[model samples]
Target: MKMTEVSFDIETVPSTIRYYLKNATFYDSSCSDNAKTVFVKGADGAFLKISKKGSLEREYRMSNFLSTHKVAPKVFAYESDLENDYLLSEAVSGEDGTSELYIENPNKLASVFGEYLSMLHSLPTEGCPYKNRTAEELNELTNKEASLNILTEINYSAIDDVIIHGDYCLPNIIMDNFSFKGFIDLGYGGIGDRHYDIYWGIWTLNYNLKTDNYKDIFLDAYGRSKIDRDGLTYFTQLIKLCD
Candidate 1:
């Protein structure tokens, strides 16, 4: 996506982050409606995300946790007031997975994507602060006003929990010259079922490439032997309900 240069008054920013805004150009890089993200262009590049108060606490914690594993950006400061929260973090190196250079070659991109996802899932979750996201998500789904009967038919007794990138779509995964760099937007990340990531891996490829051709290539690279078809189907439906 193109980041359009925009005018911003730095005086309105949180005092804790005003030091990073000196003589920096502002770009409107926001992709979500829930928050406003400004890209600070200066000698020391950074991103300033502003949102409702308390909305970013989990993201701040998750980013710090993943940064320790060398897979995410380091947070500079997180300041909150009665009205809003401001998060400042260093900009990660590399273009996101949706870059044209990578999307031009779907096969290679799919393989690299699968390999990196497998690597992420292999990381130990012993110290992870967020746990059992699968159960939490199910609770949310069950509480939804809409009636979803499929939730009753699926048995979640057997689940292979792992550290999952909750939103594993193309825009969230960063790549540097076809090599894995890091992941962004970690608000939903935590200890969850692997199928959550796998389902998104397949969905993103289809959505970005506008075809359903690369699903098997990605599944194969991630090892189909480790995947449970029933689990994948269940999570796919679960996500649809939540959406």
Candidate 2:
């Protein structure tokens, strides 16, 4: 959410997206350790993300898929060579959920956040390309330093499959005028467990607002009938271990 004005050599950008960056001012908008995101400021704004080669393939695919549902920005180009991957996408127009405007109204923000997440989960997933998220997380846990008994306590079968935002947090959910715009940072997104997204939704509210008072409000807006409180707790702990 903190974007600092900075300079970047456009020559380093992949030729496929270089045209978009020419003569544009650059801002260091990166938040993740895995990628560097430059916000290109101009009449036609865009975001240029750079990472190791092959690292952004899943993101590219998922972004394009989400665009079809009008819940994400359109991907302009995805190109990679032997050394690095580059993704250029049109910027979604809005301030993210972490903006002071939204933070000032915790009640409305929590309700809108939950409503949008429920809408995302309700999207049909007939042809989703990424469906092995649960398996992948379980695989990750296998290499973790957890005790065997603790690992056995995780009930993988209890997870409900739904298209998840993967890293669903306040900063990733964009909004304008208190209305939902779209989501960003979708590299881990795909058809996965809904609890993963739910867990982060709750976590982000607490992390950003510095309070847990909105948890019940969020769950209620998201429809508590669809939630399993015990499963949410279990998956939350399981995901923390994987992280």
- Report the C-alpha lDDT of model 2 over 145-197, residue by residue, as the tens digit: 56334656756454547899998999998889777888888899999888888
- Could you tell me which residue pairs clash in candidate 1? none
lDDT of 1 by residue, 1-243 (tens): 469999999888778789889899999999899999999999988889999999998888888888899988999999998888899999877888899988999999999899989989988887787998888787776666453567567764436468888899999988888878788888889998999999999999999999989999899999888788888978888888888
RMSD (Å) of each candidate, 1 decimal: 1.8, 1.8
lDDT of 1 at 227: 88
Misplaced by over 4 Å in model 2 are 143-148, 151-156
C-alpha lDDT of residue 82 in model 2: 84
- How many angstroms is residue 154 displaced in model 1 relative to the true structure, after the best TM-score fit? 2.9
**C-alpha positional error of residue 74 in candidate 1 after TM-score superposition, expressed in Å:** 0.9
Which ranges of candidate 1 are over 4 A from the true structure? 144-149, 155-160
